[model samples]
Target: MSAEHHPRDRRTARVGLVLFLLTAVLYVATAGYQRVHIDVLSADVGAWRIAATGEPSIDGLDTSSINRSRVDLFSTVHDGRTVIARSPGVVAAGVPAYALRQWVTDAGPDAEDFTTVPPTVTAALLTALSVLLMWGALLRLTTRRRATAAALVFALATPVWSVAADGMWTHTLTVLGVSGMAFGAARDRWLLVGLFGGIAVWGRPHMALVAAALALTCAWVRRRPGIVARVAAVGATLTAGASLWSYWLYGRWSPSGGYAPAPYLSRGAGAQYEFNQTLGGLLRNEAAMWLSLDRGILVWTPVVVVLLPLLVQTWRSQPAWTRALFLAGVGYTLFQGAVAPFHGGDGIYGYRHGLEFLACATPALVVATARVGRRTRVVLTVVIGVQLAAFSLGGVLNRPTLSFRHHWNDNAFVSGLRDVPLLWAWVAISVALVLLLSRMFLREGAREA
Candidate 1:
């Protein structure tokens, strides 16, 4: 029988379809009707333009058609010819969408006047599909309601929603790749797992950590020589292919492309780099990313705070292979935090890079919540409710400048806090409420235990 004809596969497909439709509608509604411009697309889309048209250089592409800093981010002057500085994975991902846009809209490649709505909508749909993949994976380990809730949290209550729904950033593709790997692991399909892991690394080189972690976990779990060899061989081939492509394009084998050399080497760069390289600075930034109201992950999605306790409980109950799979998120987090830029995601909604970790960790969270007590559930409900309200209010406050370009110094959340003093007061109150509820939930769990 074909794979799609399998009862489990059919049910998974139906669930995925429903989730994809729901998330796509929500994203379109939230985006409103504005013809928003996305700045990050310059690198991904510009590269797409070059590849699609068989042009080696983006020099004559209209300057206004791309992001203002297209030259700096997308391409560089290499021996008098322009060369794309970004990895090709994301650009390749956009090819089908770009082709469809051209076929349906009768649009020509006008590099100077690229619109954001079409590509942004395409990316949002892709992100919705990722949520579906994550939801399907969670179902293997939890009840239907709990799996749905986890998927919803990953899609709406977290930074993944805001960042991935907005534009064609590499992070959206990374989420899809991570979630696909999770789904493959849940189904015990080692080949699928290896393929998704390879795709993740193709999208973002750092994701190799996630891929390697998953590959090792599967090999250890099955303990079959044939499976282990197949997974290793496939993964190595895909990753090596990507590296070779990078070398061919930029004369370098770096996974991040040749945009900015020695990005991880902070030594002698400046005081910021010097501080970021220190262990003390790394820990400080990690704390700030989780707890600080300005751009912390928990600040935007207090519901995720439950994951800490859930992780502890789940770790004890889950098998060693399962634990290793979940730890991919932890490994990715440490790697990203250690080498991330000074501002951490440069002023997006929350810690955008962390969204990939959150995606990988969602299945474990679903399992953890499956058998929780009533008190824990109540606290989680309250936390989710509060997060929804906070995000709604933030949408109103930062409506005008909520796109890919607004990061770091130009972050919309920071600007909202500065413009509206009352927003800070509201945030403080919300933070306190979440903390109190979390404490209550932990105490209740402890008592029950």
Candidate 2:
């Protein structure tokens, strides 16, 4: 990297570097806080072993070992062969880690070595990189001060730490893809916009809508018809390749690579797969998502209740493409609410699905925060304090059960206060962050005034 001669730019660069290292360490250290999905935790090892030895099937391995939960990592295919649930995305990301693990353990698929507190080091690193990329994206649109703070919140106070960094969940790709979109759009790089959109689709087939929404909106807003073809073709090619591979592996063409049919626990009952699109139902899901204590954004990240209102207040002020991207995020979120429960899964920290919306509206958010009243700044500080405590509960807290999704609000606070060991650590960290951030923001606000 070239040296930045300007003092201000150099300072920003130094800050970004320090933040990267700090967040990276945080992610790696806390990775074991949550129990990852059985499939996500094991997919890396399974795929690596299969690809390394060029095995056509698992038939050569001990079938007796299937009882150990190792085999649940993959989907069975023809003639006893198997494929990782999400092809070429999550599986592909873990290839290097798998190689590293193999070198360390000197084991193969039959070894049945599995499970750990923090599933994979690589997963944590990827999530850290995602935060760094977000910081860089924010820098392109807003002042260094706001960008850094917003990125810090993105790294610590959000599900990026509690959920994505905890394991090899597919949300890892979602953050990466969304950050790529933010960066590409900010820089007016059409191919990047397309490539990352396609990558997001690979993470969650449902994200195909998000990718298309972003690409088309950008192209139309810019009045560049060629961009539509260029971006669309890129995303289309990627989605098609994944779909074809899905057909080969699971006799299905779904983007989730045959994992789409997996059991999804619904909060509102009718049927497991039911889509309740009524006005009342949609409104209810919207309210539940924003404020419900169990899985609500407010409960997990109170700062968002303050930060996210920027989406509406500053919508008209955002660039055309960014506004469209923000709206696309809203549409995708509502779609998620209609089709399934907003909890994402049984028990997780914060809102997993809100990750995409934040990524999409980051441009607008940065602008809205550029200038704020002192009262708003005070509220922001307190909420950031709450956010720090909420995500920090992961490592010190007990493993959350599937049913604990509903009980999360109660268990998290009550247990933390009651547990002697956790109380000091959790409260200390949060107090330190809130004080540190408050000083920085208040100092900056005074200078501006």
Candidate 3:
């Protein structure tokens, strides 16, 4: 609040704003760079949006549902070329209804030929708000300037980078919900926290795991009666929000699907066995690939770097709620990993499902990076630099599509393209420079800490 601190505060604000802008620009560039295509997940949502609203398809292609039941469900509900069953349910109830309705009434070009403009604009706005909320939460947990930098780094991190540019998805929405809850807890705004958590569940039911974890952590910590009551209020609110959609889509009392058998649970004789054999199923079906990729980046390597240890050593080490929230994140991923039907199918880009795990780990990773000694931090940064360089270069050269059909050994990277030595070299150099700068930044952060 003093004059001496004014310049420092201004600088911090500028840095945070710059990071936010960078994220926004990146999404805009990608959205405008290519026409919307059905190859991506969010694009499918766009297609449904168009169909539901009585608009012609962007590419005039109708999607196929393999089973008769699904087709009937879709047809009965999707009469207007839009999805009538589930999505409409969300729009009709809870927070999403508010956001979606607001989106539809706003005058704008139908960028994707559906009711909503291209997800890029809408999602970018959402992602920016999410990141800003994260900054606020971090500020509550630490110094304003340090929290700003940490949050900025988190916004630019790979998990977020992929989601924001790829357009709207449940993850972007979840990010906002999670950040809101985090900020609300920091400020003791229980009801506001409940609202965000509720919205998150409306977006993705899986977030119930996060809410449960927060509640349990609150209880375990012996929080004040009022605070504990408030946390429970958040969980109840989220459950109520999600229930509105689930009941409409499922026509059942339980939308969380706990009462119903999992689709995988009925697929074969093993179906019944699968649910009970959680860890065993994951080991046999998903773990080998999951662990291998986890080792590659975003998990093992970052932990080995000075960051985790540095985070422990920091004067402002994470509190009980923060640690519990992280544990819940881990538990959620593990629970899903154990139960998800993993038959080595089409949706597995370097294990795309793991992105959820990465999101939870990101804040910890940044905090850890901020806590290390300069020399050790430089070493760790170099390691991250190498990995990111590999990832980005591999991305560009291969024009790699993010999906499970293409695995590490698949040589899908530019498999059909003519080899160009000059272009290849240029991309490599660019990747290297980015990594190098990242390393330097980490080293500088270590010294400053």
Candidate 4:
């Protein structure tokens, strides 16, 4: 086994390094260019505004404030009872608070004096970390070479990478948390896994399930009575400590602190409604709302198509225990979609609620895609290349507003690129990708005995 495995492992490592390098190039190119033109300080300026003030919440800063207003982090709400969490307010989690406090002491309410560089830099760094984690997780699941290819595809994935570069939402942080947990699990480092799980929840309350699921997995994996007991004790203790810290801030021990249901049943109910609700009933309506908000996916159908097969491959994988973690990631993301209001269909960046799942499922794409025949691999690569080119164009130039139109947010480069010539280009690119990816499906199916 090692004889065959050795070469494959080396190749995978090389692929992973290449993928990392490519991602770095894309990120630096985009962020550096963007910073020059748009003032890096002003990109996701709301987050910085929030950090400067002592707001412990972010509930109030919806997409409505996108281009219209500047959020004041230090301003008090009516009656001085509460502070908002948005452009003007900070969520006070982990390092953001300490950083903000120090800045305030050093600079004093200058509005422009907050720690701007670190957050944006951190956002970019998190993207790199997430990609690395995905690569590692995929490596654990498959041959080294295949894992590296998967990481490359994931890093360059149109939707995932595009969002990573924009640095608009908290989804990046959540991605880091989820990816970290996955890495921990694959390595059997329950303690580190538990720590990441805690961080994931800390980053976003709705993600609390990730940590809980890890804890359970730890117990099951180390099932001997003594080892199980020890794992459980350590896992529970870590989780409790993090939960307590959160509760201390929001007076509730939850990720979505204020929004979490009274008893937690509602959270489960929301997930069920999303998964099982009838097409003609509440579920359909919910889906429609999500679609409206996530128009980006609608506009970019290629990325959308990849999601189904990605899920299918995971569903068919062996070992019920292994599959449960993947399912939990899906369930939690779908739950977010069900419960979250249609901030445009779930909020700001199309399908924002499901971004969490996208992050978790992304590694699977690389693994599944790489396992295809050579010609098929070429086709898939072409398609992904086209998608990236299309997305980059859309991002860099004017494009017909595909999503978030209510906000008049249109900086997309594809607006002009979507003309007849570009349309044909997109079509050719897509056909090639589909052909390759289809071969991948056939190969995986053939092996499914």
> Using lDDT as the measure, which candidate wins?
2
Residue 395 CA error for candidate 3 (Å)?
8.3
lDDT score at residue 404, model 2, on the 0-100 scale: 44
Better of 1 and 3 by TM-score: 1
TM-score: model 4 vs. ground truth: 0.66
Runs with alpha carbons beyond 4 Å of true place in candidate 1: 1-13, 28-39, 68-73, 104-106, 225-227, 259-261, 269-272, 319-321, 345-347, 392-449
lDDT of 3: 0.50
The residue pairs found clashing in candidate 2 are: none
Model 4: CA > 4 A from native: 1-25, 28-81, 86-106, 114-116, 214-254, 257-281, 285-322, 342-350, 363-379, 394-449
Q: Residue-wise lDDT of candidate 3 within 87-136, one digit each (tens)?
A: 32123322243245446755322433333244446666667777877787
**Each candidate: what lDDT?**
0.64, 0.67, 0.50, 0.50
Question: After best superposition, candidate 3 residue 263: deviation in angstroms?
Answer: 2.6
Instruction: List model 4 lDDT by residue over 1-449, tens digit each.
Output: 66967876676567667766777656645542232112122333434444544444334444333333343332223233343322211133224643655565754334345444445445555677778877787667775545554565555544455554445345566677777777866776655565665556545656667556545654665573343344445545655665564454445554443234543234345452343343444464345433542343433435435445554665555333245455667668556546544332211223344556666655554445534556555555565666655555433331333444442233233444444455667646755664565456444434421
Cα lDDT of candidate 4 equals 0.50
Cα lDDT tens digits for candidate 2, 1-449: 35555776677778878988988888887775234555564555445654456442444555344334433555566545665455546665666666566677775566465334323577788778788878887877776777777888788766778777877677878777888777777777878878888888777777777777877777777788777787788888988877875776567777667575444434345446443535676677677766666566667666656767665677677776667677877787777676666666554655677777766666666677755667887777777776667666653242443344454345444444565566666666786778786686646644421
